[model samples]
Target: MQTPVHGSLLKPLQVNEAVGVWFHFSHSGSTALPHLPADILKWSKNYQNITYGVLDTPFQTVTTYANNSCLLLLDGRIDNLATLNDAYQISDPSVQSVVWYLYVTFGIKGFYRLKGRFTLVLYSVESEKTMLYRPYLSGFPLYYQSQEGGYTLSTNPLQLCDTKNSVTPLDKQRVAHYFTADPLKFSSHPFHSLSKLEPGEIVLMDAEGVEKIRQPVHEAFPKQAIPTQKDAIYRAYRRLIETAVSETLREDIDYGIMLSSGIDSATLAYHASKLLSKRGKKLIAYSWKLPNDAADESEKVKALCETLEIELKLLSAEGMGPFDEVGSMAYNPGSPVTNAFARLNRECYKLASRDGIKYLLNGNFGDMLFKYGQPKLTELWKERQFGQLLLALKRVSKKVIPAETQVRTPWLTDEVKSLRKEKTHSETGKTDYRYALCDFHEDYFGGERYLSGVYGITRLEPHRNSALVNFCLQLPQTLHS
Candidate 1:
């Protein structure tokens, strides 16, 4: 089915159209023949009460399945297609096809069996029930708008508009929380009228309105016995890293990876090079060349690439003006740009697009998943652990990185202070390290994911594997070293 290209369509789609929306409009007798945004209406078809529109995005893997009565649209890649196809007795299953097979084979419980980053919409004419689902740690996004007569859903928020197709104002409260306070405070869409689907969530919408069906967190991160031996833990961790990287590599695409001197990116680059080499493919690595004012890690990045024998591409962040693109990007995801770092990130993607690179893997969030949490020294002090408190303070004070850019936001600063007043007793003065890491992870990854979509690049994070995150979280804080 043809789809509408909405406002703020990414320029990368002009060449490689990949991302798309599978919008389902269910109409009733009193609904007066529901309408979608003009873009959808232009290319959509109505079969019975449902109208489906698929928006084209760059480097998106979309699969569709229809057996007369049931229809499904899947947007995103399936890492385990071969395994799933064999288990389901199907040939070359797409992500959505696997979902359909499982749903048919094991009922709704089948969704839990699939892995990879994907968003799906399923409609069953027999049950007259339409379901929307997103996997845990989904790299894609989905938005929905529920109204009195009918509801609308799409992968692009721009498609979920009023009858006149006018856009709503920015959600200032949520914007403030994300910018100054807690980025995880609200996972909902930045638009006031629409809601964003959270990871590990499934929602069913019918004539009765929207009802959420929470899916069980996949055993990707099960509570396994932590290996006490450092060697055993390191070996297991290395295996996890290898497996996650191997699974995410797409044979059809020549993917590049983000490389820095940092352990996270460097580690992934090392493993990725080995795996890709086995198949006789040379991995290409990209590193940001920031202005001289910024810390230059080019020497370190070059050393790793040379050692690994991977082709290195350095994208310059010198001439990229930070303030100019802020307005446009703010509307892309309906969220404010956090800092100057976001500018560098966008520039990197733009450079990738110019060089014809569609997939870029990064090792972000590696610290959060590992035993990177610091002990709450203040909490220890309250219990009269004077020795531990001093040690904790020394550890925390050892390293401090200054902010890249500072903008004066008096109102935002005051409002955030007010919001923090409602913190729990444990969070009033001092907070646990895990809590801080969780907040940072949510904010950092959440914004990055959305922005990458805007730049028309599929950003992969093998390090964000659920099993890896769970294992790290289970480790003792003392093991953080």
Candidate 2:
């Protein structure tokens, strides 16, 4: 039978995997829950004792080996497949097949060989063991929990509650941090049972036991900007952006963009213009501003879109376009629980619905690849006075990094601390940011049994595109800064 594909699948291995739509609040850990959704249950029953993984949603992917010994799900885009695809000998153009083949080809090495930001899961049948993992350098959600010894993984909290005994109390410290306006976001949640996957590490479960491995992000990445010295970074960046654009536009649907006034979106739009010029596709740009909010700069976004000569749709704190606002959020699934990125997503969904566009093309992680978050910190570290850098990091965390946002909380914090402690470590084969990068990837970039399980949209992040990742990994910090 031909596999029907959405973005990802929520294959309910147990009864709780089939969650009722009534779950409103987020919970911690995996479970065996009551009120399983019929669709989930019915789908699970369709599989033989050997289960197959499928997408829980568009961004969430679930895939079980044909033998049923394993079940897996992934979130993110792979950009470097010309060779990997050739290695897998997969003629099929779909990402799933390439991924499955990669799994069959190299097992965990399969994970290492791939690039992009995601959170994923891999379960073993023989031992009923589950493995969770995240990569060192990434910007994706990865939270996991184990109850009754059975592990559950996701990019979001609510998904785990679909199981039994999954609902637990929230962590007040995390809540206080958020309410008090601390920058620790996402590392620790109010709910117990959930744990963020440390960056650049893999959580593995087997008959013997559960384990984790730290896979470093850079170093293995050659510090060159392009494959050839003859190529200018700007021109190469432009071509690569075009590649990212084409891959995203692979889906057959109307599309829109999340227009940030910054260079990231500006550059993305520049390449998009070249792509759409011939097709006469009027790229729809979505921008947002704050009316009563604390911080917002939608006017810059408006100005940028105008400069690019692209169609623009402006938004306010009030709401998105004419689409049934609430319904679209319901449809997005990644919203609400997804935090800051979630709000930005709402704008995308609203614009998509308004433009009659089925697909929304966002260059979300382009900033990460470009190191767009805090320009001066990296520079400060390079200039010495690491003390000031640490203080600045702490200062930023209080405001910029949320207790929950991976970069703001544990991932970035640990990285900063480690960098301070491990001056000689990089030479001895131990590095700080590189280590954190690995942990972040395995935990969040859709690794074996990782967390942050949010698979509810036809989501696309090409910045981590394998080719883009490969290229970025080879660049000097200056390029990223």
- The clash count of every prediction, one per candidate, is 4, 96
| C-alpha positional error of residue 245 in candidate 1 after TM-score superposition, expressed in Å | 1.9
Off by over 4 Å in 1: 1-18, 22-56, 79-101, 104-107, 162-190, 218-220, 252-254, 277-280, 289-303, 306-311, 315-338, 364-368, 371-458, 476-481
- Model 1, 1-481: lDDT tens per residue? 3443222211111213533464545546232123323322333333123333323334554555554445566676556778888876875365445666788788765776777777777776556677777766654567777654466776655445531322222332222223222222443433457666655556776665666655432233445676765556556666777888887785755677766555456667778888878887767777766556445567767777777788888877676444323321222233454444455555566677677777888642223342222333122112343344335423432322112312111112232334322212321233222121242233433444444545566677776576765665454332333
- Provide the lDDT at 67 for model 1: 48
| Model 1, global lDDT | 0.52
Report clash pairs, candidate 1: 18-57, 18-58, 18-60, 19-57
* Runs of candidate 2 exceeding 4 Å displacement: 1-61, 68-107, 114-120, 123-129, 133-142, 154-156, 159-190, 197-200, 225-231, 291-296, 318-345, 363-367, 372-431, 434-457, 470-481
True-structure lDDT of candidate 2: 0.44
TM-score of 1: 0.64
